[model samples]
Structures are given as structure tokens and as C-alpha cells.
Target: MADPHERNGENERKPDSTDDANLSARLKSLDARISQASAQRAEAEPRPRSKTDSSAIGQAFRYSAEFVSGVIAGGIVGWLVDRLFGISPWGLIICLILGFCAGMLNLLRASGTIKPARYDDKK
Candidate 1:
């Protein structure tokens, strides 16, 4: 009778030093390939600036500019309406309130607290 541990006149093969060396070499080659590919991809595609890329002072200035522009534009429109309609106080007051609201909205949008509203005209 044949020995139970033997098959085809050879013992069930155990991995030898050569197998370990070959496996280590293959693994090193794979690592080198992965690193090369990663470096190439990084060079080809630069990362975009993240939301926090803006400095605190730059963000503050941007927010203030958005708010102030809305207010100034509203004030100008209101002044024009008041001048044309002869409704002095009422026109100025109503427009000032609207301007303040617009400025606040602009500020919120600029600060990323709110999404900008978009109007689409479907013809």
C-alpha cells in the first residue's frame, strides 16, 4: 500500500525558499507598479481647491461684498423710484426694507449657509 501523505511519488508539496523568494519578488514588482501609476495619475490630474481653501479674511471680504452690493443696488433703485414717483418716504422706506432683505440673502448665500436661487425661463 502507498503512504497516505504521498501522491504521484512526491509528498504533497511544501513551499520552499525558492517559492518564497519568487513570491517576494512578484509582490515587490506589484508594489512598484502601483506606486508608479499613482504618481502618474497625481501628476495628470491636479486636485481642485476645497471649500476651506479660502482664508477667513478673504471669505469675510467676499461675504461683505456680496451683501453690500445688493444693498447699494437696491438703494439706487429705490432712490430712482422715489425721485420719479414723488412718493418720497414710502418708496425709500419700502425699498430700503427690500434692500436689507436682499443683502441678508446675499450674505447667507455667500457664506454657504444657503444655496443660490436660480430662475429658469422655459419658452
Candidate 2:
């Protein structure tokens, strides 16, 4: 008598439900692990969500530094001028005011409130 699963000399392979179920379970487990890793990585490395936020913070620091440096440099130069030329308070006052204006202009440029002359001229 011939076996029901045999066709000529070759044996036919019958599909197993358990094999399909195991493969599906393994695939689902891999997907879960990948999702968990991605979540962990995201949590571990927090980043600025927007370019504007990062640049704004940088600009704030830069403007503050520029303003302070201008004031200090002006004070030093004014003091030097007064000592060398014997003009006293007037030299310090005028130079300090000029420095303040220069600082304000720098801040405006940094904030994009004013257009750059050189850049505008180039266009």
C-alpha cells in the first residue's frame, strides 16, 4: 500500500501550526526589543527639539559678552587717554558713552533686529 503523503519517490511536507506560531512569536519579541531599545536611547540622550531654541540661547550669551567686553574696553581706553592727555573725567565719559552705543549696535546685529551693512551692500 502507498503512503498518502508520498508522491512518486518524494515525501510531501505538511505545514505545522506550531512552527508558524513560534515564528510569529519570535518576530513579535524582536519588534518589542527594538522598540524598547529605541525608547531607552531617546530617554538617555535628550536634545534640543528646534534649531531656534539652541541658537537663541547662544545669541543671548554672545550679546551679553559683547556688551560687557565693550564697556570694559571703553573704560580702560578712556582711563588711558585721561592719564596720558590729562583730560580727566571728560575723556572717560565720552568714550564710555561711545562704547555703550557700539555694544548696543552689536546686540542688535546679533539679534537680527538690524541688517548688516557689508552683507546688505554685497547683495
Candidate 3:
């Protein structure tokens, strides 16, 4: 029968120089890949901006325009309803609610809060 020690000795033996060289090359490649991935992640992440920055002003202007447009449209609809129904202020109240909804919609659109529909050719 073969000696158990001989079998164990092979398992316990250290790898040769070629194995070490292969391991070193692999580790170097992994390190390079990790560094490249880290750089890519850093580039993809959003950087912080100051509150008083020009972009902030532009965003505020966009929101304000949306809100104002909503309010104006709501007021007009309310006036028209009031005139049609012969109601003095009921239409105004309804218009106010609609205006508020429009403003919220506009805000969502401007802020990219709402996702736009995507068309696929397969459909």
C-alpha cells in the first residue's frame, strides 16, 4: 500500500516559482481593474453644487413658471365654469383646486419627478 505520509507531503508542499509568477500577474491585473472601476464610479457620481449657484436659479425659474401657468389656467377654467353654470364663486373654488393640481404636475415635470413614457419598436 502507498504511504499516507507521501500523499500528505505532496499536499503540504509549496507552489513552484511559475505558480508565484502567475499569482503575481493575476493580482496585478485585478488591482488595475479595481482602480479603473473606482475611477469610473467616481466620474459617474454627481458632484454637489452651491445653493446660490446659477443652476439653482434656473431650476427655481422653471418651477415658478410651471406654478404660475397652472394657476392661470385654473383661474380661467373656473371663470368659464362659473359663467356657464350661472354660479357666482363655485367655479372659482373648483378652478383653484385644478390650478393647484396643474402646479403640482408642472413641478413634477420640471423636477423630473415624473417619468416620461418610453416607446419601444417591438410593441
Best by lDDT: 1
Candidate 2 lDDT by residue in tens digits, 26-122: 9999999999999999999978555464776786888898787888778888999999999999889988988888888877876667986467554
* Predicted structure 1: lDDT: 0.86
Residue-level lDDT tens digits of model 1 in 1-123: 999889889989888999999999999999999999999999999785567646878888888888888888888888999999998888777887888899999898777677668735663
Best by TM-score: 1
Question: Any runs in candidate 1 off by more than 4 Å, and if so which?
Answer: 1-49, 119-123
Prediction 3 TM-score vs. true: 0.52
What digit string (tens of lDDT, one per residue) describes model 3 on residues 19-75?
A: 999999999999999999999999999997544435867878878998999999999
Pairs of residues at least 3 apart in sequence or in different chains that clash in candidate 2: none
Give candidate 1's total backbone clashes.
0
Q: Lowest-scoring 10 consecutive residues by lDDT in candidate 1? A: 114-123
Global Cα RMSD, each model: 10.1, 13.0, 10.0
CA shift at 46, candidate 1, in angstroms?
23
> What is the lDDT, from 0 to 100, of the residue 9 in candidate 3?
50
TM-score of each: 0.53, 0.52, 0.52
